[model samples]
Structures are given as C-alpha cells and as structure tokens.
Target: MLRALYTFLIVAVLSGIAIWLADNPGELVMHWRGYEIRTSFVVGVGAMALAAFLVLLAYRIVVSFIETPASVSAYLEKRRQQKGFLALSRGMVAVAAGDAQDAKRYAAQAHKLLDAPPLTLLLAAQAAQLEGDEAGATKHFEKMLAAPETEFLGLRGLFIQARRAGDRDAALAYARRAFGLRPQTPWAAQAVFEIEAAEEDWDGALKTLDRVVSAKLIPRDDARRRRAVLLTARAMTAAEAARGQTGEARKPALDEASKLALDAVSLEPRFVPAVALAAALCAETGRIRKGMKLIEDAWSAVPHPDLADVWLDMIEDESGYARAERAKALAARNPENVESHILVARGAIGARDWQAAREALAPHAGPSASELPTQRVCELMAEIEEGEYGDRGAARGWLTRALHAPQDPHWTGNGYRSARWSPINPVTGEFDALEWTAPSGVLAQEEVPAVAGKAEESVAPAEKEEAPEAAVDTVRALEEAGNASEVLAFQPPLPDDPGPDDEGEDDKGEDRREGERKW
Candidate 1:
C-alpha cells in the first residue's frame, strides 16, 4: 500500500512539471558553428526528451552485444565441470564396488576432463591397488601427499602399502607420522602396535596399547589382556638376554618376570600363563612353598595343565624321601586325579613297591564294556602280570577286554586318549601299570571291580528290587572295597552336551592360552 502511494505522488509531481513546462514556455536560444537560432520552449524540451530516449536505447544495445559470448562460454564450462564431477562420483562408486577396471576407466576419464583433483587421484590410487598395481598406487598416493588437502589419506595409504610390502621401518615411520597427525586414529595406533610387536619393542607396544585404551579404541578388558601378554613377552625376552650372564644378572630378569606375572594375575586372576610363570619364578628363587600355594589356589579356582606341571616341578625339585613324600601327599590331595595318581605310582615303583603300585591303579579299573577306564585297567593289569605281580592270566584277560572295547566312547575316553595312555604297552605287549596315572583326573570308583570275599555270604529271599537301595549297596560295596577315594575325586559329573554357560569356561582356558608366550 505504501509503495503505491509513493508511486502516485511521484507521478503527480511529474505531471505538474510537464504541465508547467507546457504552459510556461520561455524563449530558448541555440548556437552552433557561430550561427544563432531561436526556438520555442516546448519544442526544445521535446527535442531534449527525444535525445535522452535515444541515448538509453544505445546503452542497452551495447551491453547486450558485450555479454552474449561470455555467457555462452560460462555455460559450456559449467556443463563440462558437471560431467567431470559425475564421472568422478561414478568412479568412486566403482571403487567401492571393487570393479577395478571400471573404476580405472572412469577415473582416467574424469582426470582428463577435469583439473587433477585430490579425490580423482585417490580414486585412481584405489583402483590401482585393487588391480595389484602397487607401483601405480604408490605414485598416485605420493602425488596426493604433495597436496595438503589429501595428506592424511595419502599417509594412510603409504602406511598400508609399507605394511603389505613387509617394510617394517617404513610402515612404522608412516604409522607414527599418522599418529602424530591424529593421535586418536584407530588404524594408526593399531599399526604402531603391530610394528612394535614385530620389532620386539614391548615397551613401545605397551605405550601404544595404553593410547588405544585411553582412546577407547579397544575395550578396557581387551586392552588389559593385550598389555599383560606384551609385558610377559618382554619379561621373557629380558630373561633370554641374560641367559649367558651370571646368576646376579639372571636374577633381575626373573624378578621382573615374576612381577609382571603377578601384575597379570592381579588384572586377570585366572590368567594361567601368568600363574604358571609366576609360580616357576618363585620356585626358581627358592620360594617353592609360596609358588606351590599360588598354583594350588589358582588350580582350585580353575584347573590348568600348566599349574599342574608347575606343581610337579616343585615336587621333583625335592630330594630323596622328601620328594617321595611330596608326591604321595599331592596324590592324596587329589586322589582321583590320573596325573597325581601316575606321579605317586611312579614314585612307588621307584621305591620298589610293586603291590602298592598295583593297588594304586585299582580304582581306575572298570567293567570291560567301557574303553577308557578298561584300557587303563588293562595297562596296569598287564604290568602287574608281566613284571611284579606275576598274574599273566589276569593281565591277558584285561588286555583282551581293553582291545575289544570301542576305541571311542561318549565320555572319559576323550581325556584318556589325549593322555595317550594305552592299556597295553606297545613295545612289551604288556600292560603299563605306570601309564594308568597319566590321565588328568582321579580314577572313577566305578572303574574298580568288587574284590572277592570282601563281604560275608548273603541270604537271598526273592523280593522286588529297589533301585535306590541297589545304588546305595553298589556305592557301599565299592567303598568297602577301598575305592571310596575314587568315587569322591572330582567335583561332580558334567552334564552331557553342555550349553553356552559350560562353553564360557572354555573361554577362560583360552584366555590363559592366549597369555602364554613361548621363549
């Protein structure tokens, strides 16, 4: 509304001025080339207005003429730029799709049509990498590095290339540079870890791991586990370096290892490798009792072969009667354990107690139908028959039963076979009573048969059988026959076909295995 009002007022003013000019015409004089002429006011005003209109028309014509070619050129250039960008986008898509040939074609076309943009160079580099053209990839990456806009990507590419080429120094250099450029980069930290580990630079690896943890690149627990492993490895390396040196020199390494192992165990209590190492170091430093206690505690919480071995080492280091007594004590602690039983039996055999050795394996014997326990029984029977007990007939019977038994069974056989304890000795064609104890756990009481004349004659009046009563009688009979120790050996029977809960226990074992580092 206001604009219309302003326009009306301006038009009225112009009309008034026109009327005034028309009504009050003054005489006007013009001079040209020294000649004078006179004309009326209305005619001169008309002439001036006509001249102004003509000048405006001429200005419009000149501007249109000047702009036509420039506008057309700009339109063509914009179209060319759009086409180049479209090809570049397609090339990027092709790279993502792993179509190296198509990516290369589009990339080259885009490069030719447009000025060499960093994105185009990156696409070409990726295409070259996919095609296994390492040299071409490297060249493009280097070109990208020359431009500040693409330096980070170029550095990453160079690092990857160095890694693929097995150039550790270059790879490390690039990775460290990348990390310096961006400390929170996951790839850079990971690359640094790989490089440091490869170089046996555990300290550096550990520092990198800390960065990874701080950045939350890896989970905290995972970082702890990895750091523990690296620390353990470094400890081992340090120990190895002191190998030829004097005891004083070796002590520090061993002490360091023990400290590392303890730290690891503290971080992850069930870390068996650390437990074993710490125990071993403790034993080496004349702290065998402490080591034994640590190992025992760990074993009680979670069983590991290494812990058992460490315990055995401690036992073996004892001398003469002390060693024998230690073996028996360990055996008594884990009466059903095949390993402990074997160790005790070996000690007994060394002491020349043939009958005791034979008796020690009694709990391992079972009904002939089962392969594993029967095999262990047969092995013991054979040794007794051939060596000390001189019961060849019994040995032969047990051996025949063992050989006839199925090689595989639903239970027990897995552990038995893993120990590789055959019922009959391969070389002697006899049973190895000594081998019966090699299995890891205590012998099951059901394995041992009832001894003759253990109970008085029974009066039998035919009556309905009671299943629960029968089971009680069987257990009582086994106990009366001195097989109660075996019956009570393990925690309990594990359910068949265990589920996720059961499988998670296996992961604990796996974690320990992962922590172990071989010297």
Candidate 2:
C-alpha cells in the first residue's frame, strides 16, 4: 500500500510539471557542435530529456567494459582454488584407503597449488611417510612448522618421525613442546608417555600421566591402568638397582612400591601386575604377611599366572613343598586353562609329588599337543621316575608320547610361548630364558589308573551341592581364621632409620611403583 501511494504522488507531481511547462510556453535555447539554435520551452525540454537518456545508456556501456576482466579473473581463480581443494580431499581419502601411490600423487598436486595449507601439508607428509620417503616427509613437516598457524601439526609430524626412527630424545623434545602448546591434547599426552617410557624416565612419565588424568585426556580407568603399568616398571628398575645394596638402601624403594601396589589394588581389584609387584616389594621389606594377603586376595578375584609365581617367590624359603601344594589346589579351580595345568605340573614336580605330576601331564600329552608343555612334563616325569619313582620304563613311555605329540608353532622344542608372558624377570629387570629340559623316553605310563575317584570326590556333586552352604562355610572359615584381619594388618612399616641417601631413592622408587599400580 505504501509503494502504491508513493507511485501516485510521483505521477501527480510529474503531470503538474508537464502542464506548467505546456501552459507557460517559456523560451529556451540550446547549443551543439559550434551551432546555436532557439526553440519553444516544451520542444527544448523534450530535446534535453532525449539527450539525457542517451548519456545514461553510454555510461552503462563504459562501466560494463571496465568490469569484464576482473569478473573473468575472479571466476578462474575460484575454479583453481576449488580444484586444489578437491585434490586435497582426494589425497586424504587415498591416505585413508592405504593407497600410497595415489595419495602421494594427489598430495603433491594439492601442495603445489595450495602451498602449505596446514591440512594439505599434513596429508602430504603422511603420504610420504607411507611411501617410506622419510626425507620427503620431514620436509613437508618442516614446512608445516615454519608457519605459526601450522606449528602444532609440525610438532606432531616431528613426533611421529622421531618415534618411527626410534629417537626417544628427539621424540620427547617434540612431544614436550606439543604438550606445552596443547596440554589437554590426547595425542600430546600419549606421545609424551611413550617418549618418557622409552627413555626410562619414570619420574617424567608419571608427571605426564598425572597431567593426562587431570585433563581427562584419557579415561580414568585407562589412566589408572597405564599408571599402574608404569609404576610396576619403575619399581622393577629400582629393585634391580638395590639388588646388591644394603637392606637399608633398598627398604625405601620397596616400601614405596608396596604403597603404590596397595593403591592400584584398591583402584582395580583384578590388576595382577600391581598386586604381584606390591606383594614382592612387601616381602622384600620383610612384610611377608602383607604381601601374602595381597596375593591371596588377587588370586581369589582372578587366578593369574603371575600371582602364582609371585606367591612362589615369596614362599620359596618358607615351604617350597607347601607352596607347590597350594599351587595345585589353585590349579584345580581352573582345570580347563593351559597355564593353570602347566603351573600345577611344575608345582607338583617341585613338591616331589611324582604321581600327581604324571597325572597332571596325561591330558596335555600325545601327538595332538605342543612341544613346550610336553617337554616340560616329560623332563619332570623323567627326573621323578629315574631318581625317586624308579620307573625307567614309564619315563621312556612318557617321553615317547611327548615326542610324538602334535608340535605347537609357539614352541621350538623349548618352553611355552605366550605373548602375555613377559620374558623380563621382575627382580632382575632383564630378559632371561625360562628353560625346560626333557630327558629321552619320559612319557606317562598307559597302564596308570585315572584319578577319576579323587576328581569326583574333590568336586561337589552338581545335583546335591548347596552353593550358599559352601559360600557360608567358606566365609565362616575365613572369619574364624582371622584372614580378613590378617589382610588388613599387612601394611608396610615406615622405617625409623632411613639413611640420608636412602630417602631420595625411596621416594623415587615409590613414585615409580605407584605409577605402575595406577596403570
């Protein structure tokens, strides 16, 4: 409505102007190109209006001519940028697809046109790395670092390269710089952890881990697990350092580890490494009862092989025979596990239980088995038969059976192989072979009676057994035996006479052990 009203007003004004011009018939004059002419007012006005329209049209034509080149240039530049971006996108896709050749080609093209766009440079570096072109990768990464906008990317690239090259010092430098720039970044924290761990800088690693946890870069659960692993490693290092030192020198480190282990166990009940390390440290510091309690608690939660080993180590002097018997009982709890069987067999051999050892090896023998278990069983059986059992015929038969058993790829006519098994000794912090030797002709006798009656009697009848009754009985027995109080009482004792140098070493070891326990 407003637009119509404005249009009406404008039309009325124009008509009034035209009427006045016509009615007045004023005189007007015009000059053009060295000539003079005179005309009535209306005629002059009409000529002027016509000339004004022509001038306006001429101005429009000139403006169009001026803008044409700029418009064309802008259109072409836009297309170039689009193509460059497309190449970059394709390069990233190629990298994701693991197509190294295509990724490199597209990355090169993108870089040529885009010239160190951070994302483009990152892609190019990754592509170069994939193609094993370390120099090229480094150059691209350096380019990224040269620009302030791409500094973080450059740092990350350098970190990756350093790690790939096994240069812990360089990696740590890059990682620390990146962490300083972006403390909350998960990659930065992870890189720092790796670098510090590689350098055996346990103190630095623990600090980085704490930062990672505080920032929530890693989940609390994951952080604790990692911390515990680191702590265990650190504890092992400290233990090795104090191996031949006086007890006073080693006490602090062991005590620290014990505390860390206790914390770790509280955080994650099933953390075997922390439990084992803590127990070992406790025993080392003469807190044997405490260490035993930790081991027993962990064992109840999960029957870990490490726990058994730690328990054996602690009780070796107390009663090797009793320890072996305890291991056998533990093995009975998890009959289907290969490791459990192996441990039980080993324990039985240690306890001089020849018959029991032979029985344990029966199920794991023959041509359908591996060499490691078979060889271990055979060796133990041979020793028993030749020395104590006095059954050479039985030993030969068992050995023959083991020799004919199916070969396991994991065993090279040697001991068992498991990725989960750490070859490094916790006490020594060094790689050591756990060798097993089998004498010739040491196999289980085919005529031996099966211990089926004992097995059946040991396990409660499925139909008649009351689970709650057994559980109650167990609880009552534990309560009566003061096991709970015993466990609670096993805290590490702070030494009253910690020497000057011992104090620092103690804190360092404790901190390291705590880190591992957190892990």
Candidate 3:
C-alpha cells in the first residue's frame, strides 16, 4: 500500500509539472550540424523518458545473451554434483552393509564423477579391504595421506593394517604421527600408548599417557593409576639395567628408580605392587625407615603378602624370631584383615612358633572355622604341621586336602592371574589392569576316606590314589600363579631368608627341607 501511495504522489507531482510546463511553454530543442530538431517542452521531456526506457531494455537483452552459455554450464555442473554425491552416499551405505562389489562400483562412479578425493579414497579403501585386497586398500590409504583433510584417517587405516600384519614399528610410527596430528583423538592417543607399552618403551608410553590425560579421554583416577604403572615399569627396567653396575656407579640409577617407585606409590598408595617396589627401592638406597613406613602405611590400607616379603628383606641378617616380631608389628596396623593374620602366621611359622602360628591361622584353617580354608591357608597349615612336629604323614594329608581347598585370592585381571602383583597386565598390555581378587568359580569339595575317625590323617603320601586328575589340575593352577609373576616386570619375589631352625637340624638342613616343599 505504501508503494502504491508513493507511485500516486509521483504521478500527481509529474502531472503538476507537466501542467506548469504547458503553461510556461518552454522549448527543449537543439541544432546539430546540418540538422535542426524542435519540439514542445512537455513533448520533449516525454520523448527523453521513452528513450531512457528503450536504452535500459537494450542493455538487459545484450547482457542476457552474453550470460546464457555460463548459465547452461552451471546447471550441468550442479546436476553432476548431485549425481556424484548420490554415488558417494550409496557407496558408504554399501560399505556399511559389507557389500564389496556394490561398494566398489559406487566408489568408482563417485571417484569418476566427483573431484573430492577424501571421501572417495576412504570408500575405496574399505571396499578393497572387504574384498581382501590389502595392497589396494593400502594404496588408497597412502593416497589419502597426501591430502591434509584425510591424513589422520589415512594414518589410522595404515596403523590398523600394520598391526594386523604384526609390524609393531610401522604401526607405532603411524600411531605417533596420528597422535601428533590430533592429540585429542582417543584412538590415536590410546594406540600410541598401547604400542609403546607392548614394545616396553616406558618413556614413550609415559609421554603418550600424559597426552591421553590431557585429552581427558580417560578418567583422572584411571590416568593417574596408568601413569603410576608406567613409572613403576620404567623404574624396574632402570633397576635391571643398573644391576650389573658397582654400588657406587649404580647410585644414580637407583635414585631415579626410587623416585619413580615412590611417585607411583604416591599416585596409588593402595596399589600393592607400587608400595612393594617403593619399599624395596628405598631399602636398596639405605632409606630403610622410609621403606618400612611406606609398607606399614600401605599394609594398613590394604594388606598384601608381597609387603611382608619386602619387610622381611629390609630386616636383613635378623633371626627368624626377630623377623616374626617385625611381621607382628606390621600386622598390628591392620589386625582386622585376614591378610594381616596370614602375614603374622607366615612369620610365626618361619620362626617355628607353633602356638603363635596355630593361633594366627585358627580363624581360617581349623575345622571349627565357619568356612573352608583356601589353598594358601591349607599350605600354611601343612607347613606348620611339618615344621612343628616333623609329622610328614600329617603334612601329606594337609597337602591332599589342599588339592580340593578353596582357591586363594591372587592378582587377577585382564584375563590374567598371578601369585604376585604387577604394574601392568601381560594379556591386555594395559596399566593397572591387575587386581587382588579371587577366581570367579570355586572347586567342588571331594570327600576323603576316614582312618581312626580323622579324614585328614588318612591320606598317605605314597598312595597313588591320593594324586588324581583334580590334584594335577590344582597343581597346574598353583604353577600358573607362580609363573604368571614372572611374566611382567617388578614382580620377582623379595630376597630369600633362612628358614626356621628345627630342633637337632643345622641351617643347611633347614634350607634343604624348605626347598623340598612345592610352592
């Protein structure tokens, strides 16, 4: 409405001007060379307006004629783009559906029709992979690496291929490159970390782990736990390398290892392996008090047998009774835990304190106890029986019962089990994957024949019937636990000590006798 009103006002103003021009009757005329043209002022103005409209119409016609070819080309280009995109979409769908033939066909069509190399290369790679053409897939992925837009994807593909081909160095290179390109990418960071770990590149793994933490791909606690494991592993490797060095020369490495282990312990105090390592390293560096305090603090939080071993190692040259007293002190920090009781019992047995051993083990091993004893508890009972009374027959009976006893808790995680704690899981190549836990299933109890109304006393060592398939399996489980400890770094047992001295036996005899038992 406003546009119409403006048009009406303009027309009224033009009519008024035309009426005034008519009243004034002024001429708008010009005399050219050999020509003279004259008209009324109003008529000349109207003719000039008509001439301006004609000029505009002619310019538009000429411009439209000039642009016609370009317009046609643009229309064709848009149609081609639509077809190419349709092919790309179909190729992606075919790849997802696992249809190699259709994916290949669509990929070819898209590649021929479109100038986009990024999307086409990925589809071609996937199609080639589906067809088991690894070289073709690799070629496509390598081509993708030239384009910055697809470089990370290319690295990922190449990394996977290298891993599948069992080329760790190549895979690690690709993963690191990908990580450098995009540190925030979870797969790239994790791949770099795992490859570094599997290759035992502890420093590289730690650096990659820091990147992972910074990216927040994993939780803060998990990142700290993993970092602790990496540090511990590095410390263990450094210690091993320094083992052949003289004491004076080894001081620097030992110091570094000690720092790393203590850092690990600080990250995860309840982690038994780290605590044990820190304690051992501290003792190695002559900081025996610090080592003892670390063990005590960790034991109070979570008692472990390894801590006991470390404690024993720290108190070198001490008699069995002195060691037992130290173990008692350690156990005092966490008396409510069964592990604390076991620690005390192990020390008592080593000291030949029969009463103390029996009293410490009574709650878990005796017939009056509420539940069945574990394999370790039964083995300890056997140790006590033989060490105290030299009763081979009763010891053999206890060993027989141990075959069917409940399995003890061990460091189990990531589909691996060990009798000792480790910083990483050998199966999954993951840090802090192992935990102190029992096996999921328990063995069924088998009945033993009674002799003189005592079933444990009836089993004979020489009887072939005592060693069945189940006993073999139990032995195998025991062997697995003992061997798994050796699979990872920082898992060797603490320094050895002389066994408890029996009456009428020398130290050599005690050592020989202790070595005879099956661990």
Candidate 4:
C-alpha cells in the first residue's frame, strides 16, 4: 500500500508540473556547437528527460556486456560443485550398499570434479576399502592426514586398518593420536583402551579408562566394572613381579598389589574375580579376617564358586569338619542360590558326611526336582556313594548319569569359556567380560535319555557294537538299583571342576595364569 501511494504521488506531481509547464508556456533557445535550437519550455523539459533516460540505458547495456564472461564462469563452477556433491553422495550410498565397482567409479568422478580433497578423500578411502584395496585405502587415509579438516577422520581410518592388519604398535599410535584430538569420541577412547589392554599396558589402559569415564562415553556402571578389571589386572601383574622377591623385598610389592586389588573390590563389590583377588591379597598380607569379609560380602551379592574357594583358603583350620562348618556359614550368606547348596554339599563331602551332602543336593538333583541336576551335582552324588557305602557300582552309576547331566556354570565371556576367572577377555581384549554363567549349549543331546543310554548313543557305532560285557553289566546293574531316583539325589564335582581352579595353586602360578586362562 505504501509503494502504490508513493507511485501515485510521483505521477500526480509530474502531471501538476506538466500542467503548469503547459499553462506557463514560453519560448526557450539554446546554441551549442555553432547550432541554434528553439522550442517551448515544456518541450525542452520533456526532451532533456528523454535524453537522460537514454544515457542510463546505454550504460547498463555496456556494464552487462562487460560482466557476461565472469557470470557464466561462476554459474559453471556452481553446477560443477552440485554435480560433485551428487557423485559424493552416490559414492557414500554405494559404499554402504557394498557395491565396490559403483563406489570406486563415483569416488573417482567426485575427486575429479570437486575441489574439496578433504571431502573426496574420505569417499575414495571408503571406496577402496569396499574393493578390498588396503594399500589404496591407506594412501587416501594418509593424504587425508595432511589436511586439517580430515585429520581425525584419517586417524580413525588408519587405526581401523592397523588393527585389521594386526599392527598393534601402529594401531596404538593412531588411537592415541585420535584420543588426544578428541577425548570425547567414544570410538577413539575405546580403541586406545583396547590396544593398551591387548599390549598388557595396564597402567596406560587404566589412564585411558579414566578418560572414558570422564567423557561419560560408556554407562557409569560399565565404567566402574572396567576400571575394577584394570585395577585387578595391575594387581595381578604386581603380584607376579613380587613372586621372585623374598621377605622384606616382597612386602612392598605385595602391599601395592593388595591395595590395588582392594581398590578394585571397592569399585565392584559383587565382581567375583575382584573379590577373590582382593581376598587372596588380604590373606597374603596377613589380613585373613578382612579377606573373609570381602568374600562373604561378594557371595551374598552373587554366589560364585571362586568366592567359596577363596573363603576356604582364608580358613586357619585344616580339618574337614572345620572347613565344612565354614563352608556352611558361607552358604548361609546366599542360601537361595543353587551355588550355595553346591557349596554346602562340597563341604559335607569333604567332611565325610554323605548324609549331609545328599540332603544338600537332593533338593535340586532329586527325581522330584523341577529340573535335572547339572554335571557337577551328579558328580557330587558319585563322591557321596563311593565315600559313604564303598559302592563302586553306585558311584559309577552316578558318574554315568553325570555324562548326560547339564553343564555347570563357568567363567564365560566374549565367546571364551574357562574354569577360572580373568580380568580381560583374550579373544576380544575386553575388560571384565568374564561372568560366572552357564556356558552355551549347557544341555547336551536334550532329546536323548538322561542316563547311560545317552552316552551309548554318543559313542561311535563300532564302539557301541564292541562294548565290553562288564560295561554292559554295570549299566544293567545301575538300572536294577533299588531306586534310580535315590541314586540321582547327590551330585559331586568332576576332575575338571569349574569351582575356581586357583584353589590349592601357588600364588606365583595363579598370577601367571591371570592373563592366560584357556579358552
């Protein structure tokens, strides 16, 4: 409305001036270049205005003509940029799709068309990776490192490549650089931590883990667990170093190890390995009561056989009955857990109390139980039968049942299973990954009978055909036993017992095996 009003006012003023010029018409004359000109005042005014308009139009035309080439160049540059970006986008898509050929083609086209080497370099590296061209990818990643815009990206790429190629030193270097550049980046921090851990650089890994915790890259609980694992590992390393020392020389090292282990337990009280380690260190440092308390606390949170073993070791008594009494006390801490019952049974068997062992195990392993007993439970029953009745036949019968019993829980993590605990997973280089859990495929041949029949089916056909008459007689005898259910009531541990393999081992040997637990 304002613009239209302004336009109307200008037109009205011009009309008023024209009217005034017409009304006050007078002769006007001008001479220029020896030429004379004469017109009415209104006509001269109109002629001057027309001449000014022509001059402005001619100037505009000349300016446009002068700028034509530069304008066209800018337009072409913009079009090229758009096309380059399009190729870059397509290349990224092809990379995601795993179309190596298309990715490579688009990457090359984008590099040729785009002036942005930083942007195109990433596409080129990804394309090369898709094509399985490690050298090509490495070259592009190297080029990226020279550009400030792509430095972190280049570091990440190089770190991955180094790991894939099994170059730990190179990977560590790249990961450290990346971590320094961006401590908040989860992948960078994680890479650095994993590499440091894999290299057995526990101190370095612990520092890296602190950075991870500060950045809040992982959940707080997870960070605590990982930190605990690192501390435990450092404790183990210190313990190992102290083993060669004697008397006063060993005291300082053991003290440090004990402090570290205690710190780990403080972070994760329920962590079985940490608890056990802390307890063992306490015992070594002549703080047996403190170690026992740690085990009891951890057992209540999560009943683990390791805690039981460590608790037994802390006992001053060597008699079976005393051990059984202490074991019963530990079981009372986590009475509802199946491991608690197992612990009691194990103790009773050690005390030669077969009836106590049977009663402890019968709830879980008896015929009326909700589920079949685990291999460890069945084995315990065998021990009870052999120790109590001098009945080898009944013992063997229980052992036979054990062969088909469900597998007991062990230290399993990251596809690694062991009868002992470790702070790190050797397979994945992950911290505190091990947990006392049933191994995968815990139940074997579920469709088969839960007895010798299942074992017979598992044997080779020729072995089954050539089965000795004595073995056959044993199976028949077990079948004819007064009550098969009664035979299944008590379970015992096998030779390869999963209950904390560190028990009875020397401290030096246990420390050596800390990072070398068999998968």
Per-residue lDDT of candidate 1, residues 1-519 (tens digit): 999999999999999998998788888899999999789888887899999999999999999899989989999988988999999999999989999999999999899878866778888899999888999999988887777778888999998898789788999999998887888898898888866776767788888888888888888878877776676566556555655468677877677767776776677676666677778878876788878777766665655445656666775445545655655765665566655555565555556665566566655553322225544345445555445533333344444454333222111232222222222223322211112223344444442223211221131323212322333343334323432232222322111211112222356654553354111
Q: In model 1, what is the error at residue 47, expressed in angstroms?
A: 14
What lDDT tens digits, residue by residue, belong to model 4 across residues 91-164?
99999999999999999999999998887998999999999999999999999889778899999899889999
Alpha-carbon error at 349 in model 1, in Å?
A: 6.5
* lDDT of each residue in 79-166, candidate 2, tens digit only: 8888888999999999999999999999888877775488788888989988889999998888877778899989999988987897
Candidate 4: C-alpha lDDT: 0.78
Report lDDT (Cα) of residue 451, candidate 4. 52
Residue 192, model 4: lDDT of 87
Query: Could you estimate the TM-score for every candidate?
Result: 0.58, 0.58, 0.76, 0.79
Give residue 359's lDDT in candidate 3 (0 to 100): 86
Candidate 4 TM-score versus the reference: 0.79
Q: Give the higher-lDDT candidate: 1 or 2.
A: 2
Question: Which residue runs does candidate 3 get wrong by more than 4 Å?
Answer: 1-62, 211-220, 442-519
Q: What is the lDDT of candidate 3?
A: 0.79
The residue ranges of model 1 lying beyond 4 angstroms of the native Cα positions read: 1-73, 93-101, 315-519
lDDT at position 205, candidate 1: 82
* Model 2 vs. true fold: TM: 0.58
| lDDT values for all models | 0.63, 0.65, 0.79, 0.78
Candidate 4 lDDT trough over 10 residues, lowest sum: 493-502
